[model samples]
Target chain A: MELLKQSIRQRGIALSEQVLKVDAFLNHQIDPLLMQAIGREFAARFREDGITKIVTIEASGIAPAVMTGLELGVPVIFARKHQSLTLTDNLLVASVYSFTKQVESTIAISTTHLSAHDRVLIIDDFLANGKAAKGLISIIQQAGASIAGLGIVIEKSFQQGRAELEEMGFRIESLARVISLKDGQITFLD
Target chain B: MELLKQSIRQRGIALSEQVLKVDAFLNHQIDPLLMQAIGREFAARFREDGITKIVTIEASGIAPAVMTGLELGVPVIFARKHQSLTLTDNLLVASVYSFTKQVESTIAISTTHLSAHDRVLIIDDFLANGKAAKGLISIIQQAGASIAGLGIVIEKSFQQGRAELEEMGFRIESLARVISLKDGQITFLD
Candidate 1:
């Protein structure tokens, strides 16, 4: 978490009070070593939760989730943002609004992957509005799967995402908690 | 590679002579151990090539590329399928046609990630028509970077993808090569 916070301070660009761009390391461009460390930390935190599978949204979430899945010795399933031609049947879908993109897209997973007997750990790159996390949780619940907890790489503490999920009684573990990105300064929660 | 072939044989679905779905392990639902093995194999093949970075497209390609990046101790960058709010300046863009989706989309990478002095290795999940690979190759060329090779998780040998890239003189390493998917039978090329 310290390393991640340092990376944010050095490489992360504070575009606005609401947006922090980590395209340098965590988003578009990835540091595999950092990802591996994140995976190890998440695994250490939730190792005893009886997690059967790791779930995430496609694109950014896959890296951390896959790394954590490797550490946990489980399979990782990524919810696709859009429906591909190959994926047409037996789907569990949820509508998500991306505050960054300012677009609403449906995230879906095949019902063939998750079931009632499974316990799931949700992971993602950033948690701001919690829309993506909520979407993932909806799909997981539709499959009758139990939620183990939520693992986040970077959480915007100024946002209502964490508060909302915690209100829902989900155990949330965020590695780096950003308290403020005001006046082009990045502040972390103690 | 035999393990990969075995996985394809057991879990891969032959939707048609042109479409083979390995979503059970390779694409949708991913096996981390297999991905680690894949990363190791890619690293072993390109270890002596002086690969400075691992390049891949978003979603499916990220897992294998990250694994390979981890093994080789290099950074991995994935091109975004679409432009987001944060990514609006100094971009390297390429148009890719997805045969599976029957749609054309532009993939872009930030200029900050790639440079003239970098040497890149391209990694992808599947190679059919080679459009994605060609698009990536174009971006790398635009950045004035040298390409070490291409690493593919699965190759449809019957398709023109491998032949076309080979004609362009790119060294390609495909873990599992399928000769045919005719009559719903998944055959591998030796």
Candidate 2:
């Protein structure tokens, strides 16, 4: 978490009051070593939760989720943003609105991947509006799988994502919690 | 490589003569241990190529690329299929045509991540027509970066992808090469 926060402070760019760009190491470009550390941290936090699988959305979430899956010794299933031709049937689908992109896209996972007997851990790169995290939770619920917890790499604590998930009784663990990105300054939650 | 081949034999599904779905372990649902082994293999293959960075397309490719990047102790960058609000200027873009999806989409990478002095190794989940690989190659070229080689997790040898890249004089290493997927039988090149 210290390494991640340090990376954010050093390499993260505050584009505006509400936007922080970490393309250098977290989003567009990735630091594998940091991702591995993140994985270890998440695994350590939720190791005793009886997690059978790790779930995340496609694109940015895949790296952290895959690393965590490795550390947890579990398989990772990424919900697809773009529906593939082969993955049409038996899907656990949810519509997620991205506040950054300002568009609503459907995220789906094959029902064959998740089962009622499994305990799932949800992971992602950023949590702002809680829309994506909520969508993953919806899919997990649809499969009748139990929720292990939510693991986030970077959380915009100024936003309503964390409060909303916590209100829903989901245990959330974020490695880097950004309290504010105001006036071109990045502040952590400490 | 034998482990990968064995996985394909056991879990891979031949939907048609042209489409082989390994979603059980490669695309939709991922096996992390297998991915770690894949990373070690890719790193071992390209360890001496002087790889300064690992480049891959988003989603599925991120897992393997991140693993390989971890092994090589280098940073990994994934091209974005969907444009982000913050990633608007100073971009290296290429249009990729997905044969399976029958659609063409633009993939872009920020100029800040790639540079002329860097030696990049391209990693992807699958190589069929090689359009995605070619697009990454174009972006790397635009950045004035020299390519070390191409590392693919699975390659359809019967398709024109491998031949096309080889004709273009790019070094390619595929862990699992499928020579045929005819009559529901999965045959390897070996």
List fnat, each candidate: 0.85, 0.81
TM for every model, in the order presented, reads 0.99, 0.99
Model 1 residue B138 lDDT score: 99
Cα shift from native, residue A174, model 2 (Å): 0.9
Q: Name the lDDT of candidate 2.
A: 0.93
Candidate 2 lDDT tens digits, B20-138? 88889989999999999999999999999899999999888999999999999999999998989778659999999987677899999999989999999999999999999999999
Each candidate: what lDDT?
Answer: 0.94, 0.93
Q: Where's the lowest-lDDT run of ten residues in candidate 1 chain A?
A: A80-89
The local lDDT score (0 to 100) that residue B183 gets in candidate 1 is: 99
| DockQ of predicted model 1 | 0.88
Which lDDT tens digits does candidate 1 get at residues A1-190? 8999989999998899999999988888999999999999999999999999999998999999999999999999999986676786699999999988889999999999999999999999999989999999999999999999999999999999999999999999999999999999999998
lDDT of 2 by residue, A1-190 (tens): 8999999999999998888899999889999999999999999999999999999998899999999999999999999999676675598899999877888999999998999999999999999989999999999999999998999999999999999999999999999999999989999999
Model 2, residue A108: C-alpha shift (Å): 0.4
The stretch of ten residues in a row with the least summed lDDT in candidate 1 chain B is B80-89
Clashing pairs in 2: none
Model 2 complex DockQ against the native: 0.84
